[model samples]
Target: MLNPVMNNTKWYELRLQMCALVPPPTWSTFSTAGYRSQPDREWFYHFREGGYEDILHVDIQVETPVEREIVRSALKAVHVPGEETPSGFRVFGYLHDGQGAGYI
Candidate 1:
């Protein structure tokens, strides 16, 4: 059984660390602080097995050149244990169990 509190905390810390690692360049459309503040505009989706898996499976549309480049770079730099598919990224492990994988 997964501990919801611990799972959320791990994912939150991971996301925050990733946001810190790849600070959006001045020329980019969004700021790291802004991105951190707004969950809707999150760089990646985090989920547990059998819980809203659809969020991870939805296609993320990167409209502009800047956005595309940033997304690509972030995905490459931020190590999320998962496979990137045509539809979306699929995470392969659990957070609460000390497994690295969590966010999509």
Candidate 2:
């Protein structure tokens, strides 16, 4: 299970993709570059498939309008699972209105 020469993760290799309504404007021209530079690791949380399935809580607080829009526009809805919110996806490309599509 431990390959010293390759530390790549299962999720990163899969590179799941999702469609967003649109991206702000920095996703392609800027944020894309930043997101690619992460430590090449996967972040995950355990979910309870039983009683508290809908008990998840997320708090978002952004002070800047520009930054706020980027985070807000990331999610489509709670129905789509991974693509439910901005935190759900990664910067993939730009859309018709300079917005972006998020990939997992």
Candidate 3:
């Protein structure tokens, strides 16, 4: 069996950078009321799962109204260029994925 793999190591870097924007304290209710931020592997799959070829698409779901601005600022602070969307931001970059080396 083959496992999904992100070909670009930069994506990993970007994930960490972006994840840092959201402090650990607020991570409990960052996304939505019941949704927790999976700092480890959450953001990485957005591009591959959504079929986005040239951008890092992240959907920010806020538990409160104030989180909107926080998310906006974080999106701009990310390393790559990104545009705000209704649900989140579309970070312009190359985030491709493919099957990892299959088991012998």
Deviation from native of the Cα of residue 101 in model 1, angstroms: 11
lDDT of 1 at 16: 51
**Model 2: per-residue lDDT, tens digit, 1-104?**
11121112322222221122222222211121232222212222111112121222222223356645555444332212222234333322222344333422
lDDT of 1 by residue, 71-98 (tens): 5555555454454444334433223455
Worst 10 residues of 2 by lDDT: 44-53
Q: Write the per-residue lDDT of candidate 3 for residues 8-97, one digit (tens) a residue.
A: 554555455556654411211122122333533345344234333333233344444456566656544544444545544444332235
RMSD, each candidate, Å?
Answer: 10.6, 16.7, 11.8
Error of 3 at 33 (Å): 32
Clashing pairs in 2: 23-99, 23-100, 75-85
Q: Which stretches of candidate 2 lie over 4 Å from their true place?
A: 1-56, 77-104
- Superior candidate under lDDT, 1 versus 3: 3
Give me the displacement of residue 1 in model 1, in angstroms: 13
- Candidate 2 at 24: error in angstroms? 15
Model 3 residue 1 lDDT score: 24
Candidate maximizing lDDT: 3
Off by over 4 Å in 1: 1-10, 17-39, 42-60, 83-104
Which pairs in model 3 have colliding backbones?
31-61
Off by over 4 Å in 3: 1-10, 21-58, 94-104
Local distance difference test, candidate 3? 0.40
Say which prediction, candidate 1 or candidate 3, comes out ahead on TM-score.
3
